[model samples]
Target: MTGNARSEETLLLRSAVDRLKTALPRTWTLDLDLDPGRDGTVTAVAPDARLTIRTPSGASATFTIEVKRASRGSVRGALERLLLLSDGQPALVITDFANPALRKQCEELGIGYVDLTGWVFIRNDSAGIFVRTQGPARQAPLPDGRTTATKRLDGPGASKVVRALWDVTSTTGVRELAQRAGVSAGTVTKVLPALAAYGAVTRLRDGGVTDVDRRLLMERWTLDYKIYRTNPEVLWRLAPRGPDLAYADLLATDLGNDPTGRTIAYTGWLAATVSLPEGNYPVVPNTLLSIYSADPGALGDDLGLRTASPQTANVVLIRPRDETLLTGVPLPVPEPQIIADLMTMGGRYDELATQLSEATSVRTETP
Candidate 1:
């Protein structure tokens, strides 16, 4: 065959091999051969087996298989070079033994190799066989039957201290907490406030500290336990959906009250108009809309409640006693004098809405 024709054939074989590499997993290897022969056949040989295909031009390609041992690194390097230099041509890797290290390296590198009984094949060229030797296997069972599954923990002294604090709080006294926690009293003293800030513990007036609240502690502990037990990637799927507005407000208030003392205020007008069926609308009917604010203190003052549009006046406060409509509980409207006072302070909703929208947008964009 002419040099040009051989090159073209090599390119075709490389393209075919590239497709094979993508289709097969790291465990499989491929070998190809193309040679002009008297009988015009192309043959590929893998470990323990060989296949032959008749060629249209009476030319034949033959492949010979050899077994070599290899380390994971060597096998991976060989595969990478083959894939890059072969121009997509399929080459073969021949190994004498199944080297676990080599297999691991191939898996890590996403390189493909085939293990055939006692030999391995990695393909990089259409015709040649390359052999590389590997070392003896170091196989031993783990003492505790446990594998290293996660990255190492790197924080300094904090986790140990936290665990100790947990034990102390779980029990009762500061001295016992200190001893069991394996830390000095001073360390405990310093960590107690930090723990309290995280709502992990509470400080008592009598110079003792304990867990802040049992329910809150238990809930957080449970969450932490689950996260530790499962993979971190799956934690979000197991988290709970909380009350939307109330949760947001609590988060905002907590951020504001931090050491920075930065007050984050939210002001937004939430207007909902329900259109009744034809003729079903009530004339001048009293409507009660429950309003909640992250900063309840700012609702009337900073929220600009007095300057709100008249349309917002439709919302009125309902007494808890009359909340159940079917019970015939008397409407708990305040006396006329109190209503007059509220009307005078109703216009602040718009200003509050503007502030809230801006604050919320800023908070949302923080990350």
Candidate 2:
């Protein structure tokens, strides 16, 4: 075994021993057979290890696992590399970086991952453990306005394409997708390649989407969704007094199911409550109200909402990307669009985004 692969396996073994000691019952012992591979490379061969858990009573269970270090910076590259690995056992991706988005990608790809920082999630028939610790900030490691701002997916129009890609539930080509999304052919042309580059969309040689990688799509979309086209104008409105339903009911009366206008219907959590499935979000809607308006300046008067300190602000007023966003989609807020918006919310929304994707996505085993 090469020194790098050998050393990497030793470290992974140590982690398995440590975590399994607690996971397994009392008086149970754990042993690992790690194969660093003939070439001392993680990808040279997939015959990595066979682990066994033996109890004091001689009840033993054995399973297979592969340990590999994640190549830094390029999640797409990491996934492509992982795909080349042998499928004999579940692969454990050990990296120093514990990026939630990357973790999501690993899950979507059906690959198990663990970061050196002690964040780990692995599963097998014999035993499974799920522990999430803070991983590195690789999820958005680059500074603002760097690579993402320049990408073709960084716009509202491209978002239309993304929505169609995820929500439509039918195979589509460029022209078909463009017409379905009501976007220009150029926008679809530009975004599809970008999506394909990340392994989010599996395209035929002729470029039809046979299947979409939901994890990759969510991870990539979250990276740039907020800054994509425009930052929504935010204002907080203090709640006077009422049930949450009463508050929403007032808006419903004015909007009347039209999600766009001087004061169009709300989108994020509020919209999810009124439109999408339950348990899609982690928490109930916060006191903050998100509203979209063409004439936001005049919005406060009618809704009894007013600009307040951001901390105290309860209303979030957004400028529409275009009325198409509100009217064109079947849902009050499309699933992909909601996931993008939640990604920027900076709370437990990332988890919520994952749940929403799993709830909406169609998962099939990768070839």
Top lDDT hit: 2
List RMSD in Å for every model shown. 24.3, 9.7
- Candidate 1 per-residue lDDT, tens place, 210-300, comes to 4444322222223222211221111111002222333244354453343432233221122211222233332222232323222223422
Model 2 poorest 10 in a row by lDDT: 133-142
lDDT of 2 by residue, 1-367 (tens): 6988678777866775575455445666777766536446655456456556666656555444545433223565555655566344455565544455457777787666555545566555444433344443332223655532125455778778888887544577878888888888878776765565455665654656766767677666665677223555555565565326435655555643435545454566665555445544445545545565555555655666655675666656666665555452223566677777767765565555665666555332323
The positional error of residue 41 in candidate 2, measured at the CA in angstroms, is 22
Q: Cα miss at 201, model 1 (Å)? A: 40
Query: What residue pairs clash in candidate 2, if any at all?
Result: 2-40, 98-135, 98-136, 236-313, 237-314, 237-315, 289-314, 289-316
TM-score computed on alpha carbons, candidate 1: 0.19
Compute the lDDT for candidate 1.
0.33
TM-score of each: 0.19, 0.55
